[model samples]
Target: MRNVVLAHALARDLNVSAAVIAAFADAPNFHTAHRVRSSGSELLPGPGKPLITPLSYQSIIAMTQSLSRQASDWGDLAAWVNRKIEHVLLKPRHKLRNHI
Candidate 1:
């Protein structure tokens, strides 16, 4: 179950396709799985609620979009930091060489 969730999250973050995510999660019937509801409520009544409900397609898509945005933001931040670091480290060397 945790693996399925992680696979889904990674798929979102990495921009992987639904088929790939499903394969990674070992859920061959991924498309139909979400539509399935627990039948326990019908048979056992009251206390037999499902512990884990399947994620809807809309929720999955929303999650993927959110993760993609976050990844893009992080990538932008990393690029900015790399440029700053390069400027700081290289500028001093250039200054020292000029003074030499």
Candidate 2:
């Protein structure tokens, strides 16, 4: 699935260091969290700074699945949340973004 596609892409681009490829392929959020910390955090970090940990990865996956289930449970309430977001003070930004 996504892992296969990403590994295929990395293999095509980076010819050396299967360790690097495997690490990248395993945790998709490593790249994203790195980007955020490097730009948005108080301390800017290099890309090589280890952003992925066993606990953090577990938390990310757990939270993702939980949020997905919540959205499904909510049904059109998710849609309503998105529509009314701008009106609320300090709105819940983690609410789903329905692109449509």
Candidate 3:
């Protein structure tokens, strides 16, 4: 969802073709829904306590590599994505540190 929004922004800013932006926004078939499990014990956990499982470190690495490859295939879109990622990651921390 967020990726779609970013793709639109990139399309407008970079003058990317709509077809390419659509391709970039499409998720790879490997992507799947997060699994849900009981919050505590498997058998004795309280009701209404489902927890969404987080992606493993290896999964994160694989997804990052896949995205990198996809971005690279898009040429200039790759640079735009990297800049957006850096800005999103660093801007908040810098603002927080300044406030502190």
Best by TM-score: 1
Please count the clashing residue pairs in each candidate, in the order shown.
0, 0, 0
TM-score (C-alpha) between model 3 and the true structure: 0.23
Candidate 1: which pairs clash?
Answer: none
Error of 3 at 67 (Å): 14
lDDT of 1: 0.42
What does candidate 2's lDDT look like per residue over 15-81, in tens digits? 5322221111112223443543455322212354422222333344445557785655455543444
lDDT of 1 by residue, 6-97 (tens): 65577669976322222111122332432343331122112653334445444454455577846665556545645544554455554633
lDDT of 3 by residue, 1-100 (tens): 4654565577669976322111211112212212212222122113543222244333444466677856444555545555544554455654633322
- List ranges where model 3 is wrong by over 4 Å: 1-73, 94-100
Q: What's the lDDT for all of these models?
A: 0.42, 0.38, 0.38
Task: Compute the lDDT of residue 5 as modeled in candidate 2.
Answer: 54
Q: Which candidate has the top score in lDDT?
A: 1
Instruction: State residue 35's C-alpha deviation in candidate 1, in Å.
Output: 55
